[model samples]
Target: MALRFAILGAARIAKPALIDPLSENPDASLVAIGASTRERALEYAMTHAIPNAGTYEEVIARDDVDVVYIALPPAGHCEWSLKALEAGKHVFLEKPATVNEAEARVLVDAAKKAGKRLIEAFHYRWHPLFRRAVEIVQSGQLGELVSAEAEFSVPIVRNAREFRWQASQGGGALADLGCYPVSWLRQLTGAEPEVTSAHQDLEPDGIDRRTTAHFSFPNGLQADVICDMDPEGGRKPPRLELVGTKGRLDIDNPLAPQYGAELKLTLDGQETRETFPRRPTFAYQFDGIVDAIQSGQPVWTEGADLIANAAAMAAIRRVAATG
Candidate 1:
């Protein structure tokens, strides 16, 4: 049976992220749309060819819906995710899974109690490129991993009003862009690292516009993550570099593989570049979720993983606040 999905909000990311993927996938079907207001919901439903439109409660209560794709602000993610699970529906939650680790734990517990899946929508992780990178690192070709660094930055054209800029809504460079590099480092290291230091550039409103964090792993490995929402120049290519005793690997545009990506391995004084097909990251993400629901396959971003990422983010934020 196709996974019947209902969107919880009319977020801008819904189209390229969730709606288009569901439309392209035969195993998934968009059934309904629920927004903060009925008018907004109906507008989105008509625009997206979704059959049902209503309030979030009404949509989640529908017996025909199998899953809920939550695109709400970070502040509302924890509450609505619990509500969806309580409604006996699986959740495809957007990143930063929750504002904090405590909320993440509550959501994870609720999903377990409801016997439903809660996947953090780290779409990049679903792509084969990342998996291949992990394979190369773990294949012993790189030898013992020494250190890793990942960065994501985009120039701020102007100060604009958005949910991402609101502290109450969980808006900050650390929460928005930092999560990706942090998660990527964790994936490469295969172990959660402790935050050793963190620094941030804050706006007048006290929200961080840029952040740099340092982490130390148990195996004497170290990693650095840099995220900047307001860069001076044009958008910097998202990159991850891992250094081992034997060689080093560098990946370009690790965040959005849909545009294009290249992974270069430098070993034995030779450089080799690997490129992946230009498939949207969200498509892979949707397919993975569908497979997990139908075939009992493990989700890449499971509940425990979500909690760990949230905990790491919390630690980073605490360190940033200190100095």
Candidate 2:
């Protein structure tokens, strides 16, 4: 039996990230879509060929829906996620799970008490390209870990009405883009990091347009992240580089490896480039969701992971504010 899903919002991300992937997954089905209004929900459902459409409350109350995909804005994540869990539906929450650690903790606690699964939508982590890159570092072939650096930058979306430009809606480079690198650092090191320093360029609206943060982990491991919404250059390719005592690894565009990806490794003055099949990260993420629901498998971005990432982001913002 397929795991039936109802999306809580007609978010732009739903098309490529959730609807398409769930449609392609044999073990998953896009059962419905719930938007802010019935008209919007009906249109989105018709466009996506989903069987049902309604308000979020109506969709979650339906017994046919087994999972609720909470693609609402960051501010609404905790509220809708907890609602779904309370309604006895598993939740697939979008990244940056909530605005702060406190909110994430509440959501996590609710999930635990409700006995439902809550998976953060960190799609890139499920990609094989990243898995291979991490493997090389963990193999100790790179020697003891030294430092990790990641940069994710994109041209600022000029739409004044966009939620990303609103501070109250959890808008900013740190919440929008920096979360990726923070989560990546945590995944690579298998440890939470302490924010040592942070700098940000703030907009008149008080949201960050660009941010650079430094983190320190155990064993003298260091990580730096750079995220920019309005980069001087056109959108630069996202990159992650890891350095160790004996060797180093560089990865290009791990965030959306489906476009194209390259992983380079240097050991003892020898360099090799590894390529992976171009597959959508969302597909792998959907597979993980299906596995966790159907087979009792655990996913990497569960509630605890979300809480840790949220806490790290909070720490980064706190440091950035002090400067």
Candidate 3:
């Protein structure tokens, strides 16, 4: 039996990357979609051939819908996720699951009491390119990693209408793009960072426009991440590189919607190259969510990791506020 899903929003980000993949998954069925407006919901439903269209409450209440994907803005994650889980549906919430650690704890508690599965939609983790990166780094081929750098910067959508430009909506480069680089650092090294130093520029509305974070771990490994919503494109690129005692690895398009990409691993200190493609990987995480629901298996980016991320962001926000 396929897991029936009802999306809580007709968010534009869902269309090409998220919704398409969920549709292609044989074990998952896109049964319904809910939007703020009934007419808009119905129109999208008809266009996508979805079985049902209604408000979020109505869709989550439906008995046939086994799962709910909450793709709303960052600020709405906790409310919608808790509501869906209380309604006896597994929840797949978009990244930065909640605005802070306290909210995430509330969510984890709710999921525990209800015996339902709750997952943060960090899609990049599901991609094989990242898995391969972790494999190579952990294999000691990197020979005792030392320092690394990553950057995810794109043109800022500064239109006053966009939620990202609003502080009340949980908007910022740290929560938006920085989350990816930080999560990658944790996943690849399999360790919590000991020290975090950061600098951020806040917009007039009190949201971060640009951020640079430096993290140091216990094993003498260090990493730097820069996430900016305002940039001229050429100065910064969306890439991640890992350097170790042995060599370095360069990954372009670190967060591609698709699971495949070119990875270069250099060894022997001469820029010797090995090219590998990361593919057939998205299903790994999808299956993980199902197994966690059915068999009570533990999940990968859970409570502690979520807390660490929020704490780091909190620190960054403090720095921004002080400046």
Deviating ranges (above 4 Å) for candidate 3: 234-236, 257-260, 270-296
In model 3, state the lDDT of residue 120. 82
Q: Across residues 81-128, which tens digit of lDDT does each residue of candidate 3 receive?
A: 999989998888878888887888889889888888888877677666
| Backbone collisions counted per model | 0, 0, 0
Q: List the residue pairs that clash in candidate 3.
A: none
TM-score-sorted candidate list, best first: 2, 1, 3
Q: State the lDDT at 242 in candidate 3.
A: 87
Residue-wise C-alpha lDDT for candidate 1, range 175-239, written one tens digit per residue: 88899999998887678989999998988987889999999988777889999988778689999
* TM-scores, all models, native as reference: 0.97, 0.98, 0.90
Q: The CA-based lDDT of model 2 is what?
A: 0.90
Please give the ranking of all candidate structures by lDDT, highest first, separated by commas.
Answer: 2, 1, 3
Tell me how many residue pairs clash in candidate 3.
0
Number of the candidate with higher TM-score, 1 or 3:
1
List of clashing residue pairs for candidate 2 = none
